[model samples]
Target chain A: MKEGRETTGGIEYVVGAEKGIREIVRDEDVMPLLESALSAGASRVEVTDSRGGTLWACGASSGNNDSATVERRPVFLEGEPAGSLVVEASPGSQLRLNDLAGLLCAALNKIITNSLKRMLTTEIHTSVVNRTYEELLETNKRLRASESRYRELAENLDRKVQERTEELKRMHTRLIQQEKAASIGLLAAGVAHEINNPIGFISSNLNTLKRYISRFTEMMDFYRAAIEEADKAGGGITEAACRKWSDLKLDFIVRDVEELISQSLDGAERVRKIVSDLKGFSHVDDSKEDIVDLNTEIERTFNVLVHEIPEDAEIVKEFGSLPGFLCNPAMICQVFLNIILNSLQARRQGLKLHVSTKHVDGNITVAFSDNGPGIPEEVRNRIFEPFFTTKDVGAGTGLGLTVTLDIVTAYGGDIEVTSCPGKGTTFVIRLPAERREHVKVR
Target chain B: MIEFDRTEKRMVLKLVFYGPALSGKTTNLLRLHDLLSREGRGELMVLDTRDDRTIFFDLLPFFLVTPGGLKIKVKVYTVPGQVKHDATRKAVLQRADGVAFIADSRVSEVANNYSSFENLEKNLAFVGIDIERIPLVIQFNKRDLSDIVPEADIERVWRPTGIPVFMASALEGWGVVETFSRLVELTYDSIDGKCGLSEGYGLDREDFVGRLTKRVQGS
Candidate 1:
């Protein structure tokens, strides 16, 4: 399709879609070219559309005369003709014209060229400004949307943060519960055996007392028979009754029955006390604030862990003048249980735990120092972290010291650990006696 | 790559010289208008200006007609480099066949050069042209001046980008022809391989570039 059309070439390029001659060429721009051409000695000059519609004309019209000369040159844009410039004059004026039509058409073409270029430049500049403005509008809309979203998040921040903190506190309690369940379950295994001993001795004492009662009844019947016989034969039957009473062993039965009854009561009381210890330890989860004796709590914890304590293990209690501390009795006992259990498991043989409690400077101080294979520096530092265990996989839940730390801190207290690695490890726990509340966990 | 009317035997290709203010874009066009033979080119038209600064643009047209009478016209343009003239820049940048980025080489104009490059990239996209695939060259102009970025440092930084870069003192007419020759050659290749001009007519690469750069053919 390479049709050879000579090009005058373009000085300006169009950015968007091209505009037609009718759209680009304005009335005001063409009037001057026509007037200028007419002033240059042409009888008539006219601009025509591609379809030969006259858009502008100047000077008188040339009639249908045979000698009239009509000079027409196409008005071009980008080498494509959009319209034509026609210059008309009488025959005698043609030579005097000196190709005046040519010169004027060139002038008209230049005007069209400059006009089209201005139109294109202006059109494209307008398009760019409009597009940029639209883009700015869209960007402003997005910025406003983002601002409101961030503002909403900021408004809800504090309440949401507090909610999360409370949730974490509840989770922490559950973790301590799970860990405490392990130790409590172990101690419960000892409870039945602990109660079974008193039950056995009490039943034996009751049976012995029953046999003594029967022998006394038999002696009484013999005495009644002897008395009846004596009425009939005075002094003769009295010897048989005395013989029967001697065989019955009446004096020993009376003394031994009293002792057996007292001993049986003691055995029942021992069984009752064991049941109460079981109840106290089992209810730790629901433990509430109360007047607490921390020393009593330590002793009770040892009693509950009686089955796990080795026979040769020694516990030295250095009792100090500790006043009654207001705290949760069951929860405090759990704290004591965790620490004492650590001392118990530290060594099996020659395990010596020194536990002491005292009141000092408006605070209660409780310490348990164990003379076992002492904690290593690294292990001691991490012991209070939950699930950090030195014991074998199933042998430890690893939350023992963590629970102890949580409980102590909940009572407005703190715990400190010191270890020499080989000699022993000591844990010092301090609880403020007054001017304190449960510390909020962040 | 605007007009490719095969039936009309005319192909109009556009090239734009883009850069920061006073970075020698118009200078490159002026030098090219001077050096390129007038036989293949039309008159150079420089539009509105105030105080010798280009407010609109500068345009020069060059056409090459083959033996078969197929006319391939290359129109080179330079956009006004002032930041206030961004709209005009975007308008002139539309449908560009190739681009030569003329950057100021002065140490103080480094940030201005970078921002103008970004402006080029953004406006190219606005005109629906992809900067990645366009045949583009970078000319660090004003290299004769002291305190310009050293050529070694420029190469070290720009070599990895794979875009061809040139050093020039455009005011003194040092590297203008070389930069233009490379851009025109790249544009010819791109049209042949990617822009679908090869399907219409096979372009004579050596003759086309040799004629534009005023070099002997077959060199």
Candidate 2:
């Protein structure tokens, strides 16, 4: 890769000694040396100077013979010019005194040129090495900066990954808790209905037994009055009291007792109807899909939680005429139960829970709202996040809204919450009106 | 390592004045332009500027003819001292035979001086001029300013480099000629070796120096 060339020229050096010689000798010496050598027909000339014991020589010769031999000898500087040289002559040789001077000039020029070349080459080589070293230093600096940047990016990435992993762990824990709470809700609804059934019949049987005791007591009172009148009439009246008791139809009274028992049996049948209605309200069978009435589920959740709400709180329901929705009835019911219970818990005092359902835009929109201290601005955005709750730590698990959101999303629905700090909070849940075939499998 | 030809026997030597921002590179050129004999030198040509600042460069051309008929023309150039004008600096440094680095001597400017020196080295390489091969002289300028950097520290740093160093206040016109003379001597020796000016052209070193010095002082 030869790229370019560099050339230089200038005046740089001085020859000949001027210190111990007269100015005229120093100036006149070179001219005579040239003239004497030319007059000798040698076609060449030489000069030597010895000052401060330093040997300096100038020599010149001319020749045309390609292989001409020339003598080589040492030149000495003294009172007289002393230097040795040989000249070769042949036909057509263009050798002259002036030519000798030119040749000497050329030889001396070679010496100076060679010396300068060595110096410039050395300098150029050193400069190139220095430049290369400086470039290497710059490159090394850039590489170190790049390495540090990559290290910082890697550290930031690792920290972000760790934060995301922790978030995933919390979500997993919330999912487990939601599943447990859903199961518990199903159990409570079923047990409440089961206990209602036995109590209904036992109360009805006790009421029938009281009515029979009253009728038998009236008949005994009539017999006691007739026996007292006969005893007052005389000694022979005992037979008349016995006849009066017979006339009062004691046999008929025994037949009437059997009729009373039959009536009590009818009343017990009415009690059975009430118990069956209670069972219908609490559907506990956990299956993939079930046809459920939205209105009925809302009513049942309200009934179950009515006693738990504060006394000052009011519950309002606005139910629409909606067709039965095919869904995972247990899960849907659990979602309603959790939301309503959460509303009750959020109430401070004088709370109002308004639950409204409507069919609109091919979906059933169930809106549950409460008038209480609404969710604060800071925590409102995170209401559906697991473990984010305003309730006291042990009293509420904070998974209620999170589970509600998950169930709604799983059903291809959405739930939105709106709250104003001093006003109230409202949650709107939208579920698909028509069940899709794919939803039944999962 | 940069080269030019003188086909007409009139060779021009290029010397560059380079340094950090506000280090008086332009001031040195101005002083030389003002003091040198007008008859022996061309008019100082300053390439356009912005707000009296040398944005490109300043040039002062001079001519010296030896008794033996060798004509030597020396061109002195001063690069813009602003750090961002590196392209201009590099352009001016091309074919440079010698350099004078005008460093700022204020105590706060020590780092700037080093950075500028490094920049000079880079620019020189870009122009294909080997920094070590080209005769280099360090000129610490702005000595008139109080709180100047310590002289000992500057000497200690530059001594090992083996290049001539001089303290100057270009504003006061002190030590400027000494700095210029040192570069001239180095430049002459370097170019002489290459051209065989003394042996081939019969141009002696004393005659050349005497003429250059007389031209510089006669202005």
Candidate 3:
């Protein structure tokens, strides 16, 4: 191996023995001189061409040349024999110059071989490190992609689970609702039977009353003819017949008959209205919503449920002046009916219920207040939750408020409850004052 | 209940065989498959199954083309007998023209038979088929086995329902063809009365029944 060479700033150049040694070292005569000088321990050893141009040298040593004998050897580059020196001893010693030349030649050869090995080792180490770095970068990229994919899958799985959970909850709610409706249907059947009995007799009594009214009218006509004949005849016998008619209290009979006729008409009308309300609340035609008089609906509901209230209990109403709103009248009536029924159940058999309605801020507000034992603080919050009724399981499904809330919410309304434990409970409902555009047109 | 439509000149009817597990439903189908004439029937398609029992359903289709050119296609299907396969039962029960409830004749299987009948009613409702109006027949299979219920007792239990009942040994191929033919005749008569198959489609009752019976009996 040859040592690397660099030139300093100079136009004129001295070709060292190592630089031009390859061309001169082939001379036959100089070969022995080179070998003899290296063997004699000279520090510098050189062989030149016959023209004295520098050829090959070995062990080129550089140092201060002093009075004591000193020698320097030349180094070779690119496998050329260049100038050389031999040193018999160190420059500080008194060794002869020729002896020093041989030692320098051996030293230069060792320097060149060691430099070549170092360069090769460095190059191999750099290549290995570069390849290892590239592999690590590729693996990291794949790992990151796998991580992101797993994250996306986890997110999708979470969303799917949420959707399925919600669907199951909805299905459960619907099942409970169906069960409650079935029970209500059975109860309604019994109630309808109870109502039909009285209605049947009321209708019969009205027909009988009509006959009595006609009979009484005929008797009055007979008396009027007798009186007229008496006046035309001017006779005692006709006048005596008039006095007998008076003595028999015909005036009292006529007045009492008139009063009875009015009372029977009122009774028949009440029965008719009760039947009509029963039919409406039963929701025989339940497929669609209808435009209905809210006040009339409330009145009918009160009539049907009034019997359920205790005799000593009082019901007060503050009905607001408002136009009829489009709604599913039967369902709305059911809402009020359930609330009122629940209030009656909560009362101590003789409590009062106050129902009021008013228009406030473009919304209709209806409030139902009962002077019954108020709801406990713990249960007041969950009263609207499905299946959370305070009544025993068989008596109530606890779905009334939940269903009412659902219906009112579907109609774009909200409900609130306020209660004090010892005082009573109040339920306030706020519904849009006007029907929706679609409902209005329908 | 199933409705039979003879709107097309070809009268196509659907019959469903429903029962509980181990009640000889598949056995009856197999017996019919062996006895029926190959030319008049389509291939019997049994869906994937588990434990030698149907999980989805079994279909055995037969065709009886009358001399009047009216074709009567009878597609017979058997529901999965296990209690859990309700959805599959409902799917097969849809659009059914008639139903044959295969009850196990063994005394121990009576409870399962009634429960399966109730399940049949529920699944029929799910598919909007009226259970009362369909031409329904009940067949008690495995009569050859010991500990079987008496025929008189079974009739006494089911007589009030007003449905025809038959006793059979499906494994021995006894009473299988009779049960199949009775249901076929009822189905045909029902369709004839409703859509006037005989008058409107020029169908002959004797020829139709003969062809259907011969095809089902492999004669």
- Residue-level lDDT of model 3, residues A1-442, one tens digit each, is 1222222111111111111334323345345555565466545545444344555555555454553555455554322233443343345544455544555456544444334324323432343344345546767989999999999999999999999998977875684456447545644664576556656666666776676667666666766777788789765655665676676566676676666667666766766766666676756656377777666777877876655667888899999876666787766776787778789889756788999988777788889999878999988889989779788768777778877787677677889999988888999988887746543111
In order, the interface RMSDs are 8.2, 18.6, 47.1
Candidate 3 scores an fnat of 0.00
Determine which window of 10 residues in candidate 2 chain A has minimal summed lDDT.
A10-19
Give one digit per residue, the lDDT tens place, for model 1 in A44-127: 888887778987788887673343467788876544466888787765774445377778778777877787678756775666
lDDT of 2 by residue, B1-219 (tens): 222344545465678898888888888878876765565665566656789888756667667666556666677888888886664565557677889999999999888988998998887776666887999999998889999988898899889999899999989888887798788888878988987778866876776655555544434
lDDT agreement with native, every candidate: 0.79, 0.66, 0.68
DockQ comparison, 1 vs 2, better candidate: 1
Candidate 1 vs candidate 3: which has greater TM-score?
Answer: 1
Q: Name the candidate that leads on lDDT.
A: 1
Least accurate 10 contiguous residues by lDDT in model 3 chain B: B1-10
Better of 1 and 3 by lDDT: 1
**Where's the lowest-lDDT run of ten residues in candidate 1 chain A?**
A2-11
* TM-score of chain A by itself in each prediction: 0.68, 0.45, 0.50
Evaluate fnat for each of the predicted models and list the values in order: 0.17, 0.00, 0.00
TM-score of each: 0.68, 0.41, 0.36
